[model samples]
Target chain A: MTETPVKVLVVDDAATVRLYHTSLLSEAGFAVEEAANGLEAVEAALTTAFDLFVVDVNMPKMNGYTCVETLRSETVGTPAPVLMISTEDRPGDAERAYAAGANLYMVKPVSAERLVRVARMLTAGRGIPA
Target chain B: MGLVRRNTPPPEETAAPPSADTLLSQLDDPDPELRREAALGLDGSAEAVAPLLDRVAGETEAAVRDAMLTTLAAHDTAQVAEGLAVHLASDDAGLRTAVAETLATMPNSVPALLPRLIDDDDHDVRVMTAMVLADLPHPEAMTWLAVMIREDPHPNVVTAAIDALLPSIGPEHHELLRGAVERFPDDPFLRFTVEAAVK
Candidate 1:
């Protein structure tokens, strides 16, 4: 039997960053979809069943914290793990991410190896294909 | 010295839904959630847009301002165009990026609203405006790119304009492209952008 690749959504307002993340995840055999901001991300999440969400913090229409909250809220109510990545490393940033329902919080320029490893670790035993 | 603790009753707060008037007033509230809720409350009415644009100009909170923008984006009214123009020069990069995305979605509104932003004091606004214009088939896009390449002070804006102009730059505009190259000879990135575009 063939295995379905784990579906992931990569959301960011920056075109360059979105492309970079999408390429990295796509190259690693994960299905990737891109959203320009949290508004679009929420819209996509409502329609599509993604296994994971890689979200950026500061965006135009909706920021990351609100987006994650909505994902956890009854509006979408998807329990899929969310990984919040942003340039913001200020006090309480990680706490805010956790409060908003993100499973992991990472800063920008995260090492490629670390990103893939953490992604695999978090999704392991969640019934996704190896 | 005696330390005294006085018991005080909690102040009574009303739970009534805010009226339209109250909502508009709350658009400037110190709390972003309050401002966002206020904007959402006012979003369905066409009459509320004028006040919404006013709030958009001074609203410092991103979520609140984005709420206002989302409301504004739903309509294609002249008021919306004006609102977009007002935010084109915003110091907030995120807000400006949002405005650019909104403008890109409404390509018909671009020609009339975007030119003014090309000359904006903020170079990021110019770059973003140019990038939005690049995506469309509008004739004004070429003219604006030429103007930006010739006069825009920032190399980034000029480089973006050059990138936008590449798809259609023909023999007639070659000199104009060369002029940009000559104008910013010291900027390797700008020169490289022009050279790549011309090639």
Candidate 2:
């Protein structure tokens, strides 16, 4: 049986940022879907069982914090590792992300190599059936 | 909360085209998807504008808000502009940016919304407001941005103002930019912007 590529959701409001992240992850053999904001991300999550979520913190409708909270809640509990990224480097932002169930919190303009390395490291053994 | 997807068939998609009343009621549906669908279903009904604007103001879901914004943008009315203006001060940067993008697309909407947005207590919102203005043909965005450079207390907002003002700067605005450079001597980026503006 062919091994299925790990699936990831790339959520951000900026079109350019979504494209950048999608390209990087697609190149690394991950199946990726894009959501323009947290609401879209949540809607997509309900229909799909993704292995990882690369979420942006400050989004309209629902923010990354609330999105993760919902995902961890009974609403769409997948327990998939969440990697929250944001332009905000404020002191409490990361802690809030962790408290909301994110596995990692990273600042924006994250280097491409590091992003891929981190994605790979985080999803190493978690394989979902296609 | 239990994640419940309301299994009821959407009223808007029922056999007959949904009446305005049915659509309006769906706006209050428990599912965000149903609310978003209701917002989209109200398109092209002039009678739907006021009710839609009211729903937009109370909308909590971003997807639903986006649907309502799309409907409002389709109709250029004072009420629509007023409805859009309130989101500029939203804590969610994405929502604020979405409202800005919507304003940029609707020319008439920009003027009415700018003053409040430029003066918003959140400097970040003001910064975003300036960024939206930068993309428009109206000089008012630049004009207010120049004012922001001089009067706005936050360096971030000022820097955003300078960035928006730079491409359109003229010799007539030299003194204003120079004053800004002097106002924040410690802001290297602002100094660089002013130097570029003067040049």
Candidate 3:
């Protein structure tokens, strides 16, 4: 029997970034979906049982930190692994992402190889074939 | 007694509009609703810009902040744009996004400010400025994007400029986009983004 592909949601305000990330992950054999901002990401999380979330910081209406916090909050509690990506490389950016409950934080311009590798590693326990 | 209609106007209708000073004081009120009303009431008051900006820097309530932003945006002055631009460095992502949105609405006031913001030492600030340029309706937006795509040192900032340029891509931009791909020859993402834009 074939195993269902691991589901991933990639959220970003930039259409080009969303396309770039989605294209890379989809080609890497993961099922990928898209959201424009934190609010949309939260709304999608409320219904979908995604195995992973790839979110961006500095989105309108909502932001990555707040989105991760809400995902981990009691309202829409989901323990899915989150990978927060941003252009911000400040001293506290990673700590803030972790404090908001992200499993990992990466700066922008993440290479395709590293993104796919991280996604696979984070979801390895979910039985996704490497 | 026979039914009779009172001829006097209602007290609410006769009340004087709140003074700018009263509204300014209410910006610090305990009730958010009152603060929001105060912000709304201060719209277009030149003297209120400083205080309104002060409140915006510390205003935690989204509703009040939004009202304040709207009021501040109505001024559409360089001073207002500069005031809002300072928040782009905020740790609060939401505030940065809000400030960007507000800045996008003040095209007439932003041209003088755009170059400085795009050239900021912080890459994140530059990226946010690129994001604003993407949505800014001014005709010079494309020109600014081209400069950023060509000159900015950061790949993320250049990619953001490319994103802003994609919708309006033309023959003139093809070479520039290709140059960006060549500039960052090792960056697959920038190459992919430029390919997607030019093709």
- Among residues 3 or more apart in sequence or in different chains, the pairs in candidate 1 whose N, CA or C atoms overlap within 3 Å are none
lDDT by residue for model 3 (A1-130), tens:
5688889999998888999999999999989999999999999999999999999998888889989999999989999999999999988999999999999999977989899999999999675544
Model 3 interface DockQ: 0.81
Q: What order do you get sorting by DockQ, best first?
A: 3, 2, 1
Each candidate's fnat: 0.10, 0.07, 0.80
| Residue A62, model 2, lDDT | 68
Off by over 4 Å in 1: A127-129, B1-199
Ranking by lDDT: 3, 2, 1
For candidate 2, give the lDDT of residue A117.
90
**Which docking category, incorrect, acceptable, medium or high, applies to candidate 2?**
incorrect
Each prediction's Cα lDDT score? 0.75, 0.77, 0.91
User: What DockQ does candidate 1 score?
Assistant: 0.06
Answer with 2 or 3, whichever has the higher DockQ: 3
Tell me, by DockQ, which candidate is best: 3
On residues A11-130, what C-alpha lDDT tens digit does candidate 1 reach at each position?
A: 986555566677667777788899988999999999999889999875656878889999999999998899998655556778989998999999755656677777777777654444
**Stretch of 10 with least lDDT, candidate 3 chain A:** A121-130
Model 2: per-residue Cα lDDT over A1-130, one tens digit each: 5577899999976554576678778988899999988889888999999889999875555668888888888989888899998655556767888988999999755767888899988898865322
